[model samples]
Target: MSAGHTAVTTPQPRPVPVEEPVIRCETPQDECGVRDLLDRLGDKWSVYVLVELAAGVLRFKELQRRIPGPVSQRMLTLTVRRLERDGLVSRTVYPTVPPQVEYELTEMGHSMTHLVKALSDWSIAHRPAISDARRAYDEAHPA
Candidate 1:
């Protein structure tokens, strides 16, 4: 090469772009009964009942007392029936002089203890933020 001249290099070819297959993983509908199960769990009463059951079994009257104020007796009964139907809780009847009955968590219900505990932990951890939000919202709405 001459001192004053520069050599030009040819451009390299770009690699062909690979087209990856779009894998459609199974959705909730793909499972036989997952949608129904999710619907049951999504209920507020169901989660509350499960949380209450975590402490151990209780009679209907006891559950009525432990749950927050003003829950109707019919509502509690329905929640128990739903939980029992979903296989997450068990209802036991004691055939004594007065037929005592109790409700407790089944194996599946026991499994949900961690999830309930997590929700409780989160409520405690974010209490200040929740309080602030409530204050701001109430101030703006003036109810």
Candidate 2:
């Protein structure tokens, strides 16, 4: 209560109103094309195969080698089949003395290069955070 001091009231900031997210749960079957594509893209193996194919057309063996870890023959078969059916990948067979098969991205799949690349970039950037989380989980429950 100094004689020359004046009490000042600070203005309170208004809370930012969070607008509810518009969730369109109802979409006509016709508009489901992109949604279907997104489902395919979201698949773990599908995205891996797509990224590998982006380098160039690869033979089945090459794809198996390039992808890290061991993937079952059945899983690879199913993933490729799904991608092919979705028109995102193309499989070609060359009739040689010993038949050769190669998988390549179709025009539609090629269109997703930027999106996939962005995802790859994000993964690299966030790897430390992901690793830290894993370490924390392991520490919380020791074997």
Candidate 3:
């Protein structure tokens, strides 16, 4: 053992505390409602819309452009509508010749986005491990 050397350690980042109370499912009705909302929010299109809106407000066309795979117009419309219904997004329409419209995240939406962003960060950080697991599974089981 060296007498002069000291141990070194990496510093850790502080964690952000969750401020909002999670929705509780105490009854059958409550459980159904909560599950429905979660299902809608977890869908692929909804996640994409949320990611785009997290940046700032955007018109419908802008949302369409930002999301990859060029989500269909009907699908985009449906996704935003569902999010709006759930109070996570606000829609503003301007009375003009073309009827300008824009969508932005509500206060609650921002809170939800924080959680989504954390999940996204975690996914990116562990992508290598996820791929390795998938490859190992595929190799072990051939079609």
Each candidate's lDDT (Cα)?
Answer: 0.83, 0.85, 0.86
* lDDT by residue (tens digit), candidate 3, 1-143: 45444333434666887786665566676674667657766687998888899999999999999999869999999999999998989999999989998999999888888878888899999999999999999999987
- Candidate 1 lDDT over 1-143, as tens digits, reads 66445434445678998887454336655755546657766766777788788899999998888887677889989989988987889999999978898999999889877866787899899999999999999999996
Candidate 2 ranges beyond 4 A from true positions? 1-35, 125-143
- Stronger candidate by TM-score (1 vs 2): 2
Put down candidate 2 lDDT per residue, 1-112, tens digits, no spaces. 5645544444567899988855444547565356776788777688889989988999988998888878887888899999999898999999996889899999989988
* Per-candidate count of clashing residue pairs (backbone under 3 Å): 0, 0, 0
Deviation of model 1 at 44, angstroms: 3.8
Clashing pairs in 3: none
In model 3, the Cα lDDT at residue 136 comes to 97
Model 3's TM-score against the true structure = 0.73
Order of all candidates by TM-score, from best down to worst? 3, 2, 1
CA lDDT for candidate 2 = 0.85
Off by over 4 Å in 3: 1-34
- Maximum-TM-score candidate: 3
